[model samples]
Target: MEAEDFAGAAERKAPHGDRGGEAPRTLPREQLIGRLTQLAGVGNIEEAMRCLSEYVGASRFMLARYDLLQEQGLNFIVTSNWPFDLVRKISGVLADRYSRSTELEKCIALLQPSFEDLPPECRVPPGMSQRYCSLLFCVGRVRFALLLLFPDHMILSQERLREAALLAAYGASFVEGRSQRNDRDFELTEREVECLFWIAEGKTSDEIAVILGISRNTINNYITSVMRKTATKTRSEAIAYAVRNNLV
Candidate 1:
């Protein structure tokens, strides 16, 4: 899908007014933090995301792997309440944006909320905004993005959005950490996981070496180590294992 396709689709979804519904209630920062902390303690990532989304006045939420957006299928999605069709329609645009960005640009986008207009073909729930918000965060070597759909004419709080992103990251880290503990025998070093992430992005060893500023041979060695540790026969199988285990 070309970038122009997204622009044309989004243009048609714009121009809705607020329907005078009661505003979403806002929680005090301290209380919000406390609630999020409790959710994180129990590894309830879905609830944590929902709480944050509501607090920030969004009607829906989608948590996805930023590094795996380019991959086909919804396997990269961790959790979401978005319409399945909407997700499928916009995934290509999101992947295009991710691929065009440099590593430094992506790192700079961490925890920063960005809004994008929904495509025309997407039928958002009544009273919802045509635009959606997204923010990125890292949990270990893996990066995740939280996408939100809000109401029309609602002004979202930037501070709360940043806080929500951080809290979401904390919750995700807690869950990912617990999962990793259960697979301690198959643990890969941080470098190996980094390599896995790039390979999953469809980069060759030489390209990954350039991106990481390391030797191609070193990159290959890392992949070799990852394969051995995961007991996978090929790079494709290793990447599959990483995705299944949420190691990337």
Candidate 2:
């Protein structure tokens, strides 16, 4: 490394044209990694939604979990933004329409973002307004959609859009992984999940027996089986797992 060589290299450095004479703002790769890993550690849907809303500088975000089938299809769980009734109404309409778009369908299939021009055929319901949006990404098993909303004509930077789409993928991964964990978190049968749901609401085994129309001994046996299957030594631990896994 000669000093002249170093001087020539420095001379070759171009002015940052995009920054108006200032240095270009940069996020450290390590910082991005930490942010991503933090998102990955997110335990469930709500936390994932909160992280994404904050990350993308959005007023709110919507996470709609669906199951795509031919008939009686598209069951949804929408979190974030709008009243419950609004979410329900809007989702019911949008799921079928959005799923039918060749572009949106392709985006979901590829797990990629597809930017759409707005006032799209997938129109926003009465209360929402946006001129454009990116489909972001979807996770198939959960059949989740990540839609970002902003004021009309607010152009999203390519870099930011890429970051948001990447974040959506991570969000989807965390959600899917947590659901899989919940599926395995209990060794309990459907009956046991029902029992735990009631017990977590402060019902006793006797109360649960009455609710399920089973005998007290049968209820006890179910509880024991639940504890064994969930690998929880006590009711408290089982409940803790339920709470942690969002099963209740």
Winning model by lDDT: 1
TM-score of every prediction relative to native: 0.81, 0.46
Candidate 2 residue-wise lDDT, 74-94, digit = tens: 234446664455444455456
| Model 1 per-residue lDDT tens digits across residues 46-65 | 88888888877788999998
CA shift of 171, model 1, Å: 1.8
In model 1, which regions exceed 4 Å deviation?
1-23, 181-191, 201-203, 207-214
Q: Report the backbone clash tally of model 1.
A: 0
* lDDT, candidates in the order shown: 0.79, 0.53
> Which of the numbered candidates is closest to the native, going by highest TM-score?
1
Pairs with backbone N, CA or C atoms under 3 Å apart (clashes), candidate 2: none
